[model samples]
Target: MPQSPPTISPTFRLATQIEAILYLKGQPLSLDAIADCAGCDRETAEDALIELMDDYAHRDSALEVVEMPSGYSLQLRSSFQNLIQNLVPAELGTGALRTLAAIALKNPLLQTELIELRGSSAYQQVQELVELGLVRKRRQAEGRSFWLEVTEKFHQYFEVDELSLILAQSPKHNGTAAITEEE
Candidate 1:
């Protein structure tokens, strides 16, 4: 009989696959998606996720697995946030930057007001920001309009308080008060 290579256990294989999927996606992934990608059942996927989470937790690694409302994601631990942020350059474009600045300056801003202030392009900017995990949109109580607010991720990524100080000191915003303040 010919010699054969040893086989990997399903649990180990599924755990490896799930880790790769989460790493590549860079976002939360539902259990169903993990199972589909790993070619395993839901129970297997859930087990793999738990295994991965525990593995990361026990290790002294800077990264961790987190469960969000949307799904599960692999990310740097809060303690490592500043260190990683310093290494990665910001990826926001000019339009997105402007939109974010506007929102950060006047958070809980109504979508209507944003559109009026930043033009129709604000819609696309908002979408991009949301995808980047920097902004969140919620339906307004009174109308079909949405309320735009910066998310915790935004604060983590940009250190909003620092940005706010910079913006306040900027000549452009020095004399200009927040739109909400005017009303």
Candidate 2:
């Protein structure tokens, strides 16, 4: 017998929306991307996004589904960005910042790769970035390669969509953090 693909259930639709809101924020997302992640059809993913958009609109949320050069991203309504900026103190320092830039640029790269490029200190840098919620680590196959990627917070700090700048700024991942004055 030919195997059939699993269908998207009502519960699955809701879950997919939640994951979309969490992962796709400040980024473009294609229906196919969402469908791939949700393990459902593109039509189903589109339907779920439409439904989620309506739900947010009805609630008059501080966030919204926005179309960007990349695709669809859940972004903070312009009115709220300033308010958020005020909460994060300027004294946080740059160890986290440099680390953030490195991960944002070489995303999905292994921790060891980062360390090798930047040296042993890179581990401490990654640790600090992870602590600040600016970066995340995922264990991959082949002896737990740590996958490094940026968090939503990283997006808000630079006010940019593409992460290419970080790479151009620092190709070798040096664990040494940079110190900068308040902007």
Candidate 3:
């Protein structure tokens, strides 16, 4: 007899899609983010998350979906976590990383400009980056907004000497970020 592929119900498929996003992100994502990435609506994404969590609860798996104060993520089930100790590097939340990327790409970017580029949330991410020593912030001598830039720690931590490769590969976010502009 020939082998047959296992069939997945639409709900189960949606759950798997959410699973992929959570795994790839390695960070918590809200219902809206999950839905946007999954090509579904918030309600549908919520249902999918529930289904996925239920599936994990019933399976003998090392990983499980969890809800954090920030949002939803996939992580090693509590009991199995010791197996991954020191395996994963400390990570920034997705939002903070995105803000850092914007600042790095636009070296010596202005805080005001960063806010415009990354939305109001950039304020918090910038503060976090500064506290981590990956970014530096200083009062603008000529303006109210501060100046922002990546620190040596950033280059070392990310292990890249030149950003030209990254520059060549990325397009502006939604074609709106002024990453190509000459300041």
Residues 7-77 of candidate 3: C-alpha lDDT, one tens digit per residue = 43555488887898899898899999888877777999899899999999999999999899999989988
Error of 1 at 20 (Å): 0.5
Model 1 reaches what TM-score against the true structure?
A: 0.48
Q: Choose 1 or 2, whichever is better by TM-score.
A: 1
lDDT of 1 by residue, 119-149 (tens): 9999999998998789999999889999999
Worst 10 residues of 3 by lDDT: 174-183
Candidate 3: lDDT of 18? 86
lDDT of each: 0.83, 0.65, 0.83
Clashing pairs in 3: none
Per-prediction TM-score to the true structure, in the order listed: 0.48, 0.41, 0.48
Query: Candidate order by TM-score, highest to lowest?
Result: 1, 3, 2
| Residue-level lDDT for 136 in candidate 3 | 97
Alpha-carbon error at 77 in model 2, in Å?
Answer: 1.1
Candidate 2 achieves a global lDDT of: 0.65
Clashing pairs in 1: none
